[model samples]
Target: SVDLWKEAAMLVPEYFENTIDIWEECDVHWSPDLEFDQAADPAGAYADLSSDMTKSNSYRSWRKQLRDFIYRDVTLPLWQDETSDLYSTPEETESGFRMRVVQAIREQNDLEVEKLKAKFKSKFESQRDRVLRAEEKVKREEAQYKEKSYMSLVSIGSSILGALMGRKIASQTNVSKGATAIRSASRAAAEKADIQLAEDKLEQEQAKLKELEIEFDAEVEKLEQRIAPDSIKLEEYPIRPRKSDINVADVALLWMPFAIHANGAKEALFTINE
Candidate 1:
């Protein structure tokens, strides 16, 4: 028998249900810097995480294409039709469909054309109401599919989804002295995983920037080794934006929920000012 967790793409709620556990997991009660991914995994605990990361990224890219088709192509025309009430009755819809067919008939007439027209008439007579109901059903399914697919991505990343941009948020003003830390093995693992994820994201970006700088340096070095010194020196490459440009406030606003899921809503903070 397959475990249900296998069916689920991600299992975040299991990790971040308790508020106290998260702080202890990352050892954040002592130091926030300790929550980095390097500190999270004790040995080689996160080894199994790559399969999930690849699935989540690929699914996101695939769903984006599907969303375009459903929203841009199928759903909109039916939605417009519904809003306009353009085909309120089977007769009206059938008549409109007939007019288009007849217009086609006028352009190219033949016995085969008459037979096609008769077939359509017979279909309308037999299933006009059914056709109208099916049209409505198809539109509903398309709308539902689009909504579900967009949400599926969050669940797919079961590790880091705390909440989303459009959803409602809890007020931090109602704080309790109850937000104390916990000390447990499982909780520690969850907090560590959260820290690891953030660190991984940061390092991935840092590595990309570092690679580009190296490539640019290599080219510049080759030019100096070959060309005359009188050659117009290439302008110094502009530095990439420092991680300091990142708005800690903005990041905290976004990352709290992810930490909530990753570390059990443990009062996680991305930045603090004196």
Candidate 2:
């Protein structure tokens, strides 16, 4: 097969550097004995392989040979619109390859959680501080109230003392007027006391009258007792004898006639019978 790569390079030497690199990477992947690079794309690897491009003179010559062979024998059959495995390897990340990506995602979530925790911590501290400040303010207000209440009580006490002192000074300064008022007050008090005393005297007089009335009644009762009749016993009266009307002469004379007739008749009858 004719190597059109060399002819194409001769015609367009400006693209030789890139085309030569593509050839080098493909020769390394698919060795001389193998007919096809069915599994590897050296063109794709040329863009990303880790190699010192400056020291690849011998590698470049061998790559040119493989490139010439591939362009004439294989690539000429494929169109410009068609994709080839030799030019492109699919970019795929297996589950085994995803370890780094998962690590990055987990790190991001951890960072977000840490930030949220920090934000919440800050908010909590702010709220706690507000509560503490409010408590302090309440304590301050309570202290002020207690102080005010104490001051008010002291002022009231002072006012009362001042009033009492003023009254005493006025009373002492105007002796004549105060004396008259005092006498009037004393008179009123005395009247109340006199009323109480009079009530006591009246109660004592009533008690004496009650005692005299009780004594008079007792004396009257004694007089009545003396005039009342005494009770007599029934045994003190003699029992009356019962009188019968039958006389002793009536009984004896009546029985004496019968006695005389009975004796005479019996003696005559007996003398006849004998």
Candidate 3:
């Protein structure tokens, strides 16, 4: 087991040297006092590490890369199936471990996304209903206004004809011209004021309807932007496991080699597992 571990450590630089530029001297250390479980849970370890990482400022630069290494690159003999060889290469274990982590992350992300979509959908439905109701109210009011205006026009015409007939009759009977003029002006002013009031009421209702429609449109646009398939990037989603989801008993602490290099002004770290 010691010889195999040494061989695995030596092979690490060969695979990652171009990308990670490792130091020539590699050290191995183990703590016999610490109790390690027979099998390690990578996802649980990821969750534990994530919780710790968020609380500390350390490893900020290489946090994502570290997580990728644990999920996609790391391979332990304890993690292999009983039917499989005890000493499989990293390449042999990579695909299975990567698939497991990917599936877990994707499932969690999908759940959260569905919840988000449902919330948005509910809001959209509510807004749509409100818009529909407003539209109906506006239509009803418009129809009533048209009907009332038509009746008002007919009444005004009749009133005008009656006033003219009354004036003609009064003039023939030698009634006072001033008195007739005063009565006609009063009725005309009252009718004009009623028509203006009705028009103002209709205009207010129309304005309210327009405002509602605008709000509905805005809601639709927001929903589209939020729940669009193309707009969702799985990589961007925070699909990490919660602290409570991880069991401390399942975690194993292991020391792995990491290479630090300067890329322009920024420093980056890369790691490989044995």
The lDDT leader among the candidates is 3
* lDDT (Cα, tens digit) per residue for candidate 2, span 1-274: 2222211211111123445444333212211232223444333322233333344564556445544544433322211111111111112223322333344444555565566556556555655565555555555555555555555555555544654667763554445444544555555555555555555555555555566556645644543443222311111111221223111111000000111254564211111110
- What pairs collide in candidate 1? 16-264, 25-188, 37-196, 162-257, 260-265
lDDT per residue, candidate 3, 1-274, as tens digits?
3122212122222222233422222232222233335554453322123343343333343344343443343333423322111223333454454344444445655676576667566666665565566666556656655665566555655555665877664453334444554555555555556556656665666666566657656655554453433443322111233333322222123433233336634232333333
Decide which is better by lDDT, 1 or 3.
Answer: 3
Better of 1 and 2 by lDDT: 2
Query: After superposition, which runs of candidate 3 have C-alpha atoms over 4 Å from their true positions?
Result: 1-103, 167-274
Q: What TM-score, computed on C-alpha atoms, does each candidate reach?
A: 0.16, 0.23, 0.33
Query: Between which residue pairs do clashes occur in model 2?
Result: none
Per-residue error (Å), model 1, residue 54: 99
**Candidate 2 — what's its lDDT?**
0.38
Ranking of predictions according to lDDT = 3, 2, 1
When 1 and 2 are scored with TM-score, the better candidate is: 2
Task: TM-score winner between 2 and 3, please give it.
Answer: 3
Residue range with the least summed lDDT across 10 consecutive positions in model 3: 2-11
Residue ranges of candidate 2 with Cα displaced over 4 Å: 1-108, 168-274
TM-score of 2: 0.23
